[model samples]
Target: MKDVSGLLERTAQSQGAQPRCPLTGTLMTRGLTVPMDWRRPVTSRERQIWWNADHSFGQIHPRPALDEIPEFYDFPTYYTHDDPNSLDSAEEERRIGALGRLLGSIAYRFERGAEPTVEWWGSVIPRGARNGLEIGCGNGDRMKTFGAHVEATVGIEPDQRAAAVAREKGLEVHAGTAEDLPPAIRARKYDAIVFSHVLEHTMDPILALQNARDLLTDTGILSVEVPNNASTGSRWMGERWRWLDTPRHLNFFTPDSLRACAQSAGLTVRAVLFRGYVRQFMPDWILDEARITAAQQRRAVTQADIDRQVRHSARLLAATAMAAPEKKYDSVRLICTR
Candidate 1:
């Protein structure tokens, strides 16, 4: 494998150059061309899904079933169990909750190590503006960190259980999506609106951005962080890319595509920065590829397979860390103004 750190630095240096769109073969000036026929329907016995191989976009079947929202907290297969109406036994729920916490802790440790402050808003956050909002504030840890810099912080979460957890931590969390902000929240303007790893899950990202724009003050900033589809990790992993968690992540955005999307929604991009998440991606890729290969062979994933990938991933993580610079990143964070 190429040194992850060296690859990242090379990628960063070429950020200004335009790359050809994989689908259209056109030199992408702003965004890649998304063909109407690019969607390939994926059929399963239970449900239908679609994937745009060219643009890296995934969509769930049963098309416009608006009320179907999956319960994100339900355990071992956190997001894999996609039945929106499925319920678990009390014991199962407890196990699932514990697993969720454990995974969240691991992710938090990695993220905090990558960005100690966890506030990548840059100069977009104006001085003396102490109010902020976070969309899809899962578990509220990031919101807690934001609280350190702001006097007042609130969050909009669609998951009822997750919202309750955030409320328990004394956060002013509303149990809903950003599309319809409660009247009280809508009445107040904010210095910043954060969509940390949330926009990709939204059904309509552009509309979500427009709605978020409405709640912002004239000088308020919108800080978005999403997995970069144009990253070296995506190029290397192809179909096994960790970020392509389908039925959940609806849209994949590269920096250029995201900037164009933001501009289309009437937000002006100010700055774009990347954050390295090789630790997360490399291990996930190993695990997912193993699971996929096992499924293809009509067999269950074994402990031995899991252990082997885990061991290999550990080595890759160590190498990546050693090669990576203190400031190099994998995820793209964009700061925009309305």
Candidate 2:
């Protein structure tokens, strides 16, 4: 591990002094040097990830100052800016293949108990919530999902371009970080506030949580979901894990760290749930790995590709069920009340 330690020391010197954990002020360690992922290369900024001593949390060292973060969000390819309305419905349906949709519909009947990503998110908003806010609500997707339950849905997006798209959808979006809220948002109390994978992007998650708590009414729900740093994915893949999309993802949280961070923000942790291993996550890994293994990889979808995908995905399903159950999955979701 001498090489690793030397790398961390060199990284520290280049970045100018080590960075402490944003939430706890603990010294960070386990410096992992990684290249930007093939899919989400937000910036060319060289970064090293450092985990807190307890291994419960990790973050990019030399964390970009709040204002400097915009440079990393190279807008066009950045997914948060995807305006749903701009998508052509014909092309969208084509993307979701006809045969796949037919099979999925049939399977969906048998899998009625399965929670859709949107429904799972909507479940956390307190019953009778009149107004709800989604921090970092990109294109207002989840906001639209929860709008049925709540009378009104609002969003806070740091990227002005993304916020403009959400606003075009008639969503009341504030283009600012939760750590520093606009007066309009600070003036009102919400019945529910959702982070939904947004907290990790903030400069100070604890401060963001506190601000969210303060924005809540007497009875409110605060829902948060972040990549589980201690998940089977992270444990198995280490620095190679897909979720460690650093520079974009500043904070890495495990279940315990998330709970502690939430409590530190002065919110009551009602329940914590771990989900999204086999269903939401593993398929991509399975398909990608399978593609690399097969000699006859094809650019165009074919019956052979379908058969291969199904076979590989089934094996992973069985493996995940046996090996990484519940709390060991990819995401950590929490429901908090105030």
Model 2 C-alpha lDDT per residue in residues 129-152, reported as the tens digit of each score = 888888999878778876777888
TM-score of each predicted structure versus truth: 0.65, 0.75
How does candidate 2 score on lDDT? 0.66
Q: Name model 1 segments beyond 4 Å from true.
A: 1-64, 71-124, 281-289, 292-298, 303-329
lDDT of model 2 at position 21: 67
CA error at residue 65 for candidate 1, angstroms: 1.6
Note the Cα lDDT for every prediction shown.
0.57, 0.66
Alpha-carbon runs more than 4 Å astray in model 2 = 1-16, 37-43, 83-123, 279-318, 323-328
> Could you tell me the C-alpha RMSD of candidate 2 in Å?
7.5
After TM-score superposition, the amount by which residue 257's alpha carbon in candidate 1 deviates from its true location, in angstroms, is 1.2
Screening candidate 2 with a backbone cut-off below 3 angstroms (N, C-alpha, C), the clashing residue pairs are none
What does candidate 1's lDDT look like per residue over 1-338, in tens digits? 11123323433432334433323344433322221111111221222233344444333332323354453233433432233423344432343344322432343345533342535334356777778999898778778776666669999887766676678889898876655556666768888888988887775566678778877788888888887776555554444445655545556777766776688678889877667554453334455655643543456667566555555445444444433322224567778888
Cα-lDDT of candidate 1:
0.57
